[model samples]
Target: MRISRLVILGGFLTALLPVALLAVGYTLKTRALMLDTTLEQNELFSKEAALYIDKVLVDHRNVLQFTAQALGADALDPAQASPVLARLRAAFPLFDRILVAPPSGVTAFAVPELADNGQRVAGANISDRAYFQTVLRTNTAYIDPDVLLGRTSGAPVTIIAAPVPGPNGGVSAVLVGTIDLDSLTQLIGRLHLGASGHAVAVTREGVTVAHPNARLVQQRFNFSGTPVWQYLRGADQGRIASYVDEENTTRFAAFATVPATGWKLWLSQQHADVDAEFYQLLASSSLWPLGALVVGILLSVLLARMIARPIETLHATARDIAAGDLDRRAPEEGPQELVSLAVAINAMAQTLQALVVKERGVRAQIESAVTEYGRFAERVADGDFSAQVMVDNAGDLERLGHALNAMSRSLGLLVSEIKLATAQLGSATAEILAATSQQAAATTEEAAAVRQMAASVHELRQAGESVSRRTQAVLDMAQKTEVVAETGLHSVEETIRSAEQGRQRLETLAERVMGFSERTHEIAEINAAVAELAEKSNLLAVNAGIEAAKAGEAGRGFAVVATEVKELAEQSKAATAQVRRIIADIQRSAQAAVIAAEQYAKASDAGVSTSRQSGTSISTLAARVTEASQAARQNLVAAEQQQAGIEQIALAVDNIEASSAQTVSATAQVEQSARSLHDLAQTLDDIIGRVSVRPGAERRVS
Candidate 1:
């Protein structure tokens, strides 16, 4: 059930159940009491009707006995009884006749003259009459049943009979006064029966003696088998009973037995009529309770609203909160306890809202910090580490920012150290490579000198065996010339190859340096792009901060986020600056290396040309030694001239030796520089390795 309906029903039950029970009990009690009172009233009416009939009979009998007494036994005959009877009948108009009957069972005299059944009363026989028989048996005045017919009128009458006195003190005749049946009916009709209420009289034989309806008077109203009859049969008077009458209407009746005639007088009323007053009283009394129920229902509705409205408000507010609208709150407008409950709910909502806002702020800050740190990491991967995370006044994030700033400073210092060491190492490696080229050239020159000295010795040995006397000087000169030429050829020809190879290697190195410079330029361009992005990010953060401020308290969380974004932008700016600086250094180093390589190439070309000339001079010296062997005296003279050429070759060889020696010395110095460069490179590698930098593949989250 909905809360409103449930509350209404509950309130109604609480207020109405007991009242309903009490109303039922009152109705039952009132019904019983009213019925009892009605029955009593009916019985009283019956008794009053019985008393009226008895009085009329007693009065009639008294009058007849008095008149008979006035007449005496001396005046009982027709002549003496006539005037007395006339006066008696005149005094009581209800009487149909006044008869004087004897033991002969004949009526001797009757007032209004003769009143026998269409017969003269002077000699009328009444011996068989019940009243006459009753008088003779009882020797007293008696009232007969109203069912007996009058002699003259032939109508039912009450027979009031009494024995006439005898001077001998024995009964001689009976005096009878027949009262009209209508008199009894009129007497009974005078009873206190309201509208729809009536009285009826029945004889002991079940014959209707008197009724308010004349037609029912002499008719057979057989109440014998009924509750009225059963109760009144043994009752002398005032009997009460209930039964369904001839009309199929349930009735309550009371009966009283007439003492004079053994007849029962009944007063009957319909059950509905009997209860009319009770029903009126019942209807009137219900207003109070009905009014109370109406008032209760109204109050119950109000109470139901009081209880349910707050709960409904709370429920609605909770739904809104769950849906992420944390601003709604319950009302505090119900009962005291309910108001307190509403207050509690509102407090809970506010607390939860605050916590949620705080959580959102924290989450945004963390996410912004993570993304900014990721960009910072990217720069660090590209060997730029001069950036620093900006700190804020926020508790945890401020502390985190401080830690990050410290780490960035430390990394920047470490990278600076590494870059300086690498630069020095690169310079040393370049010198070492140059010196190795020069030393290789000098080794070739020495190896060629050893070959030349061996060839010259073989030639001199040939001269000593053939032109032993004149070829001595020629042999000496030839050996010197071959030695110088061979020395120069070895140094010059191999140096040509060494210089070319060195030149090629230097060209390669310069090209590689240029490539590295290009890469640096790319890195610089990337950094410039990052710097531009950071500037845009900074502007966005500023706009966000402004919006957050406009949003007031609701935007506190966003304010934090904006601050974090701005800090990230600043960090990017610092990193981009660092990258640009490093790129400039790389460009300068590449240009210097290119200049050194071009100078080395020119020197290598000069060394190759000088070596070709030395090879030609050695060939000429070999030809002159052959001449000295053919013409021994002419060969001696040509050998002297070859000596001059040998001197010139020696001078050229000496110049080549000096150049080679300088190259070798330079090579040795280059080797030391290379060793130093290798050590510096190892230091740079160790330094770079000290802080592990995962490439872009490693994504960072808060």
Candidate 2:
């Protein structure tokens, strides 16, 4: 069993045992006391009965004394005696008979019914009894012994006797008063004390005089022979005791002696009847302690249970707590101390539960933060800088996430810058390569132009040799023709004067044509410079395209602008080719015209030689012929003017050569500008690369 069960049981036993013992002790004591009380009540009732019988005897003695004195009086005559007997009988009804006896042997006895016959010599022998004899001899009143006797009426009687005085004063008549014993017997029968309790009257000699039982009255009682008689004689005047009678019935008896008549009055009661009442009292008292003991046991059990229940609950709760169930709680109830304990225990349980939950939550957060940080670190290690970590709940973990995100963004920007720089570098290199190719093409064209100039000089030498051969043959023929023409010289003199005017007009026309050729070469040089500038702009546009690609999405519009520039460069190249072709056609035409002018000059020289020979042959006619020869010289002069015009055209060709040299210098400057643009693009590429962006999988340049 548990400790609580033991305690409760112990408490119940402790409470019940003493109360049970007390009840038993009380029951025994009460029964004994009730028995004592009943015995005392029976003794008191017997004493009261004895006292009543004694009072009746004293009243009879007083009546007898008065009658005796009346009999002794001198005034007592026979006639007076008869009246006196009448009065004495009327006054003392307890008396059976009354008589007056004189010394003359006359008797005067009064009977209540026989009053008519007065004094008579009657043989009522009470005059010879001891009490009657004593009265006559002693001259005193006396009571007679109980005797059997016949009065003057022949009735037996027990009587009282007194001596009446004589006229001489010795003895008069013997007075005898006879008592009725039957009447006393009837009075004793009427006395009642209690149930089974009765009164008895006995003479001083132990003779039964009067008793409630009719058979016992007027009987002789042997005082020395019977137990009750012996007890009454030895016992005190008023004494009480319990005894078993001859019939074997237990009785409580009391005895009293009447002083006036020397009679004993005894009262007796049954002991069993008196003790019945005490038993009832004992029964009633017994129930009280029994009820008290039962109630005490019940209260002890209730109190014990109340204290133990909470302790048991606390024990169970403790066990559960030990087993790791923090949620269990004990109920708060019962006594002050118990309730307080329960409250404290429940508080402890709740606190433990809260602590467990808080610990779990903290642990979960720590693990989550560790896992998230690990993933972020993994991404960073792989060079995938685009991943970002998000922070929540604003703690150390959140701060760490923010830091990682910032690093990622910085790395992304760095990688972008590096790609831009690489692209710019590639564009610059392409520009430099294009510029070097154009320079090589220009050098090859210059070499071909120099070879063409050598071929033109060789052709001019061959034309000079053909002119010398023709001059010799013409000289011989001119001598023969000179003789024949001498006569016609005078008529030709008028024509020579007209030819000199034409020579001056032709010189003016040649100067104007040479000025137009110089102007055209200057215009060709301006157009060539413009073409080179357009080509340089196209190279700049290509560099811009590289920069736009490097800038990625941010430079898309700039790339479009670069494309338009490239188209403009192509249009400028076409216009430059057209200008170069026009310059070449002009050079070819000018060379052809120079060749025709040389041929015409040779023919005119031949004509002038022939005419001069003819003019030398005639003298008087020579004057008139001089006039004719002058006309011929005028025509030769006009031809010489045309040759001067051709010489002016060759000067214009030399000026065109000077303009071409200037155009070549301007093209070289344009090529230099394109190379500078390429170098600037390369610088931009370096700057963009140096500025870090987010790193990609590799550090490769585009």
lDDT of each: 0.74, 0.62
RMSD of each: 59.7, 72.9
Error of 1 at 163 (Å): 1.3
TM-score of each: 0.47, 0.37
Best by lDDT: 1
Best by TM-score: 1
Q: Give the distance in Å from residue 326's predicted Cα in candidate 1 to where it truly belongs.
A: 3.3
Per residue, candidate 1 scores C-alpha lDDT tens digits across 54-133 of 78778878877777666668546888887877787888888777777778777666666644445666676788888788
lDDT of 2 by residue, 306-391 (tens): 77777888888888987888878888887889789889988988898889989998998788777767877777666677777656
lDDT of 1: 0.74
Mark the regions of model 1 whose C-alpha exceeds 4 Å error after superposition: 1-25, 114-119, 237-241, 282-290, 301-313, 327-334, 343-702
